[model samples]
Structure formats: structure tokens, C-alpha cells
Target: MGLFGILIVASILTYIFRDRLFSRNLETKDDKYNAARKERMEEMDRLLDKINSRGIDSLTPGEKRRLDELSGKK
Candidate 1:
């Protein structure tokens, strides 16, 4: 086989596996960010519910800090 033949085979293999490799890398970072965002939102919702059920004074300083952080106030 010539250099050109080897190059062609390599290119074909890369193309065939490209989507799988791309998706695996993409999903790793994408899913992590998505999960983090989702968890933050859920925590915020739970805090809001707690405030509604009780009162603002029901929040600890740490919970208040978290709420403020997520709201972009801190």
C-alpha cells in the first residue's frame, strides 16, 4: 500500500468514529453543567418554598447566602 492509501484509511476511520467521540466529550461537560444548573434551581425553589411556608427569618445565614448567590446578588 502507498502513503495515500494509508491516509485514506485513516481518514475513513476518523470520520466513522467522529460522531461518537464528539458526542461523548460534549455530553460529559454539557451534562455536568446541566445537572449543576438544575440542582441550583431546585435548591432555590426549595428555599423559596420554605420562606413561603414559614418566613424569611426561617433561613439560616448560609441558606440566605446561597439564595443571594444564585440570584446574582452576591
Candidate 2:
């Protein structure tokens, strides 16, 4: 095949495997740490919203535990 044909094939393969190729094994520790922190913050916000809308007593046992964990009390 010509170089142009090879490039086209490679581009198609890259597009086909993009998700598997790009979704794993490339994160640095800082990236992972930031992602984890963001997740925790989002969860905490959700929990706090629930508490505000209802009351602390509305929290299930598991939710309460997760709150403590996110708050570093656990």
C-alpha cells in the first residue's frame, strides 16, 4: 500500500480503538488524586444537600458513614 493508504488505515484503527486506547493507563498520580478529590467533593455536596433539604436524621446509616469518611472523621 502507499503511504497515504497506510495513514488512512492507521487513522481508522485509531478511531475504532479510541476508547480502549485512551481510557486507561495514562493518568499521573496527581491526575488520579485530583479526580478522587473531585469525586469526594461532589459526593459531599450531594450528601449535604440532602441534609439541608431534609435533616440529618434523613441520612441512612451508609450515607452517614460515607459523610464521616469524606469528612475525615473515619
* lDDT score at residue 57, model 2, on the 0-100 scale: 100
User: What ranges in model 1 sit over 4 Å off?
Assistant: 1-26
| Every model: Cα RMSD to truth | 4.8, 5.3
In candidate 1, list every pair of residues with a backbone clash. Answer: none
**TM-score, one value per model:** 0.61, 0.65
lDDT of 2: 0.97
Residue-level lDDT tens digits of model 2 in 1-74: 99999999999999999998888787899999999999999999999999999999999999999999999999
Evaluated at residue 64, the lDDT of candidate 2 is 99
lDDT at 45 for candidate 1?
Answer: 98
Per-residue alpha-carbon lDDT of model 1 for 10-72, expressed as tens digits?
999999999876675455778899999999999999999999999999999999999999999
- Which window of ten consecutive residues has the lowest lDDT sum in model 2? 19-28
Pairing residues by index, what is the TM-score of model 1? 0.61
